[model samples]
Target chain A: MQRRFGDQEVDICIVGAGAAGGVLARDLARAGLKVVVLEAGPFWDPQQDFASDELSMQKLGWQETVLVAGNNPLKMGHNNTGRGVGGGTVHFTGVFLRFHESDFRVYSQDGVADDWPISYADLAPYYDRIEREIAVSGPKHFPWGPFAGPYPYPEREPLSANAVVFRQGCEKLGIKSAVTPLAILSAPFDGRPPCINRGFCNQGCLPNAKFSTLIQHIPQAIAAGAEVLPDCTVTQVEVDEKSRRVTGVIFVHDGTEYRQPAKIVILANFVVQMPRLLLNSATPAFPDGLANSSGMVGKGIMPHSSYDVYAKFPEEIRLYKGTPVLATTQDFYETDHTRGFVRGYTLHAHGARPVAMATGISVGAGTWGPQLRRAMLDFNFYARITQVGEVLPSEKNTVTLADEKDDNGLPLPLVTFGYGDNDLKLIDHAVAKMKEILTAAGGKPEFVIPDTAHLMGGCRMGADPRTSVVDQWGRTHDHPNLYLAGAPIFVTGGGVNPTETVMALAARTADHLIQQARRGL
Target chain B: MATKSHYPHYNVLDAAEDWDPHTRKIVEARLLPLESVEHLTTAETKTLYSVVAALIDDDRSEILDYVVKHFDDTLGKRIGESQRKTGVPPQADLIRRTLSGLGKTARDNYGKPFPELTVDEQHTILGQLERGQIPADGIWMNLPQKEAFTKLLSLTVEAYYSHPKIWSEIGHGGPAYPRGYVRTGPGLVDPWEAQREE
Candidate 1:
């Protein structure tokens, strides 16, 4: 039975309604455990809230004040984070990719980042299960990665002009490229329709063609008896000092503070918020923070080095005519010491809307007035390719508390990040390769825009308690009843999108939690 | 002088009738008249209008008015970027201070208010502001000039490009909803999409 907002204890209390939290809610609720999900943002009905206008659709992003510091101060808005129940999944491009087998044992393979406690074999089944369940559409034979060929759904048809030019370039260079694996449905499944090439996937999908936890897992979780409470900002995770276990979370809804007790607590929020919550929940027993035995609660955060290279072609390439990212090449995804970088990157033919194109040129190239207007005038003649370069973990890159406090009376999170030498070299190589590809396709490579995306790591998972915050199953080192899920626990961010890996890890954690509950642990 | 468009024949509003009702309603709202200025002072509003016009290189009053009003609305609602550079003030504070500081710079250097300055002079000051070469005294003390200028320019560009008139000028297809693209081959265009004249 669902417990009321009081002292009543439930089986589990999950503190976020994003991808990992949604998966945990559905899995655990279906197993007959009472669950309650606390989301800081509203529960949006897509048809009512979603719009095609870029300015208005930006409300889907997390808009709170987070102080950023470092040489490369990260721009934080619609690109990196999200608001509402679905979190970043609501507005993310549906490029679903699994990390390579070598990604799990990076230290052993390349001697850079620490190796994950678990391997690709442990999470392989979960990845397969998620891909089939989500109806990922892709080509029959993926040219790279450990698992190749025969995805659950066939590749999407009628490639966009941007994707066609990308493929032509790769073909001219004798390089392999294929249709990107996407979470967007290509065929009708479970009452949802296929994609219609609306080109507004970044602005919340209105037709239910793209997959989001908001439209998919949360609904299933609700059906399985999980109570989802939206617009509740969790202030702190209350812990019992004597027992050394987390009791529940204290959240504020409509200016009223309420504490809902639970037997187990899960911090499934994003990288910044997860660390902020832990650091703020410091008690007499744990002065540094809860789950800070190794003092790794807010350390080693990584953001993928995503930079765009724009090229001009004689023929018009109306980039906004189809899905944003359709074709990709992982030819440089593996580490090649010969390239002067440790790990490599994945290049995708990315589509750009009018506003994004204009702003990117303005910020990236520092063009204004006549120069900017001239560039926008030739918007149709431009095709863009972006790189997802892997960034190594640095302990200096961290999330710490700021002097300022948010409306909820908690100190604001100050995130610090900077690209290491290897990361910069990787970017330079990818940019040159992208220029080569565009030149080979009979286009003039015009602008190279530097940017970043996909935030991962902070509460890194590892085997040793002294060096890591969480175990392989997402159980924190200090507390038995407390768990951390999602991208926050990523040991080493791979040179690909991190959403698939996040959900797979969450599924594995849910399985462990269910088995433990059955054993009455 | 008017802003010249590469695709002079294209008009994105022609397909507005085909969009979903909700999306159409939101897009059409951008064309509405300015209700009121809720955040900026009268002086700040005037200076901002001049700054946006100079930065975008367009002097049409309607677009400028909408841009200023949208900036004000954003400030009034306190909606801003998720994060900021450490040591930088909040956007509202920075914008307010920068507008006043720009006026001070104009009066001190050009012997005129920001709106009364020549287009070339205005461009020169903007360039200096972007490079953080603006003197740090009075209203500009402890202020990060480049960061403030970038934020203002980004907000202005966003507002200006989001307009349907600008969309047509750039040959953007506006919002495609229930009627999505059918012909998406390389360099292919659907009948409803924008077509550039030779």
Candidate 2:
């Protein structure tokens, strides 16, 4: 039976129990506030439910139908973003890197995209706190992004054969490479064992070594008096007609509708769902949608335009034995207009599993029958380098309500995206650079897989109410009590994974809420 | 009795046998026959088998039977139900129409059905279909022939590779569960993993 709450009232009601929601839940509940998190998916225990299957993990990703259209259309939903209590963190490869100082002032520095309302300095403390809280492991003194201190845990040792070969290429090409900062524990910390290098981090680590919010934050939050309601879909956010303040959220659990009243409502659902929820909550006073006074709620959706370059080697590499994405080089992370691109892309060695490799060889390698069979036999000799590049915000690349409705009778999200000229140039340069790196390591570049890694933007935060949805604190200008969390607040997506920054901003938002509550909010 | 030469180290349910109970269930669930095949007609299933056999260069009737059944079971109900902008037909209809087009191509080019064509002839017909070289007014026109071939080929390859016998031949590590990796440093191999004989 689905657990039902009788009170239907809490000091704070969070929409999604993802990276941001998990942090907010623990922090808010620990601050003595009655917090409740509504997760639209099941909560799986790591040790009990994790596995090493590609098919199962694909299902764990959001599979519900989403309409994607543009000059360069994207395959959304299933292939990207997880659908569970831990959200994307459940299936994340755990490459957590801090945003560069240039990431904060992209607009001011490059004359493109809007600069973040809050600086990196403002979010530095939270990043340090989250890294310490999660026991992040990395190289001790990496001259990459600015950080307050060294990694909380020691670095993961003995890089994968794929990374070793890729690093040889990096050295030959004069690119600085380092041990990727990872949430996967490198040593025993807080009773959790170190990573055994299971090679299935993308498939949900069974050993509980990978730091998913499901393993840490959710449990702490539950212990700190935060109620977690899984398998519950929030359909609409009801607001007071006269005051325009969010009254409560109407959700469906086990086919039964429940209205949970709250003093504050936080939408921490990943990029796509967050904007969909806001647009679905249109009221008479706010027809364009609640907290969408600027009409920027679902606009400017950006999932980093990414691609993968795979190379064939003469000898076996056994790229699948270690953590997926064991090493990453951000040498190309900073923009250089001389390189013929306005922004840059981060290139990393891909730790692809057997099933993923088989699929890639069959489709991407351009072989079939006896040749395909030979390629599959030679799978151990291939290595992949992935590019995660920034895409400047465009008014056209957006998330809107689809014509079709979901199982719950709510309209599905329709994402329309197209690569800009600058994006195309960056992708071309990144792919060429990756090929050069592979060539330097005595491997032949084989194929390219056009894909996106992280999703950001829609419901972006800014100081101007007329131009952006939420303020720097993630507080919506229309509803002072309503706040947004996670990648949706990013004014500009950095050339790195967005998970660490999402958690950091959540910490900052929680502090903001605590300060506001002290002022009788 | 001599040990089997082909699939010499085959375990019928390697993943299930190696994985913990929970992980085993997940792997087992996919292996079970999908209920979606009930939506396809017996003739449609037969056509799928023949087309898949031609595409993958598999002549064994049983392999063709298993491949088509697996594809139908997994994706029969959803085919042709939704159309992406890429022009790939709905899952069900794509299989139906593509097979229909292949049979027509076989008849038009060599005056024989696809299943009756020689292996080389079958490859010729498939190549034309894959390259979008088939006549414009026919079945392959409306469908994205290349994308359709890609989708079908991918599914066929997945089904073939997923079998226990193939796992042995390809030297896969099977499932990682209670026994996760330990010797995972650069070029390191665990004792249990498949070692390439010199």
Candidate 3:
């Protein structure tokens, strides 16, 4: 029951209809281009949004990051993909942020951080368009990263309890703070309802207040004339050597193999598996990978630096019942030469959802009877704050194909990453800030948790083939049409949720691809 | 046994060293996340309502909206504990380790947090509850306690088995939320009505 690519040849064959792929497909198809998207996941069911259930353990939850197996024996297994048509967008906690201007030109400013192939100005408008299209909310007047514009989305959601505390803490500490720009609807606009205050957005939002691709871009693309084939995993790509162009893509459906030819092939599989598809695309002309001639394939992968902090409170405050995150402090976002860390982290703290908070208390508190319940009841009041720091990309921290094979027999990725002193020292500074907030919040006994969750530096972007994988527009130097999105293309991880920047990059890539297509090679 | 939201972290070892060998058997087991709603006893079900009531009273909704907009999944010390419990040192596996998954759902679904709990302790706790042995002490899961562990046989275990609604709720749908189930103690029963096995 394998379905071959529809009889007609499409202008572009895009693999991985996840976040970036799905967005790009809609844009390309709407421009009167016959585009075929081969998604590994099927149409996701909102009814199946079960991350909130008591029965739904983390094991059952869809993964946010790829779990690199093998080499790292101590780490858990599963280099995961957000399975289903919407890919990771369906489950991602909708935090949108543009890499600040300093982020776009880190190497130029401090000479410490790496440089990107393009400047923030080149991608700023795309960021604006994506936010406007997706209805991102933040202050229009405030300076963000390196760019600023009219409020693309109306600011509406009230600051969470922890955000309130974070504000107070910042005020006390005299640090600049503001509500972060986000994809979530604050008050309600664009005919969509406002957030209903359901604390389970990450588990999946049925209300559609959260701007998942399924609710926003994909729907528009469909209305404008685009066909999406779900549960379709593209296994390989075929390129014509003589033409030096992608002939089409070869995929499988229902255990049967099929091929679809197109004038252009777009690999929109984010960073992790995007390379896998290209690497697997073996032909006489390009033996190493579809676009891996520069030998920079799968090099310079950058995940954001993860920031974390935990604190206890005396009152029964019920921290878990509210929105998980709301406001952010950008005081440390740029080239603050005074600081020891190369790149500063963004400060963010908000209410903890009751479910997750209770779980936190239980880790230390006794489990079983009265003690566990009391810990839950007691923790109803405790608060915690954290930050996301941008880490500079070093060649050493990277993701490579491992010797171990997955269930698919494809070599799984083995990631080698560790925090340099710069990151650790920044974390210590961030923790000190966290401690001050906890103390000011009247948390009688506040303590810093430990070091964890700083993601950055891999598959970096730059103009030079020697140092970078993709150009500023995210196009790979080796493959003209293929583009990489998500955190992987980041030359230097910016201190914030990279989703918004990712949206901007994807939008920018779409526009450039159309321009190239019109030129007709 | 309290449900998973009762503890904030779950799933997979971060480092080879974090696991306490004794808790391995307990950690691997998957208990159902739910108790069918209709099966709940009157008091245990009431407890669930009370927790929700308290949450609503605290304006949990307003707070959640804020944090959702600033979401970043990062696990700190809990990851260290995860690695240390298994006696494995931290390595690259650390970055990929997610403490968010390990939250209370695992505890609620399985009724045990530590993976290495001895078989004897497991049986002792289960057998006492099944035999309706209400200890003289209050409850271990409840707060402000002295002889809390002594009351383990009487309150939390009974509520877990008797209240099918709490069990079902934890076993299905969303990640197990915290305080959805009620605590057991004085508000629940009189001494004479207690199912103590003399």
Q: Count the backbone clashes (under 3 Å) in each candidate.
A: 0, 6, 107
**Candidates ranked, most accurate by TM-score first:** 1, 2, 3
Give the best candidate by TM-score. Answer: 1
Model 3 alpha-carbon drift over 4 Å, by segment: A1-7, A47-51, A54-81, A147-150, A282-287, A354-377, A444-458, B1-198
Task: Tell me the whole-model lDDT of each prediction, alpha carbons only.
Answer: 0.90, 0.79, 0.53
Candidate 1 Cα deviation (angstroms), residue A257: 0.5
Summing lDDT over every window of 10 consecutive residues in candidate 3 chain B, give the lowest-scoring window. B80-89
Ten-residue region with minimum lDDT total, candidate 3 chain A? A70-79
- Expressed as tens digits, the lDDT of each residue in B1-198 for candidate 3 is 222343233122222133223222222222323323333334333332322222222212222222111111112212211111112213223211211111122244355531222334433433343343434233312221222222222122222222222222222111222212122111221121112111
- B4-82: candidate 2 lDDT, tens digit per residue: 2223453535445667787677555544443445655765665676677766656565455556666766564431122
For residues A243-272, what per-residue lDDT tens digits would candidate 2 score against the true structure? Answer: 768877988988889888889999998888
**Tens-digit lDDT track for model 1 on A404-479?**
9887778999999999999999999999999999999888988888999989999999999999999999999898
Candidate 1 lDDT: 0.90
Candidate number of the best lDDT:
1
Kindly report, for each predicted structure in the order presented, the TM-score of its chain A compared with the true chain A: 0.98, 0.97, 0.88
Candidate scoring better on lDDT of 1 and 3: 1
lDDT of 3 at A10: 77
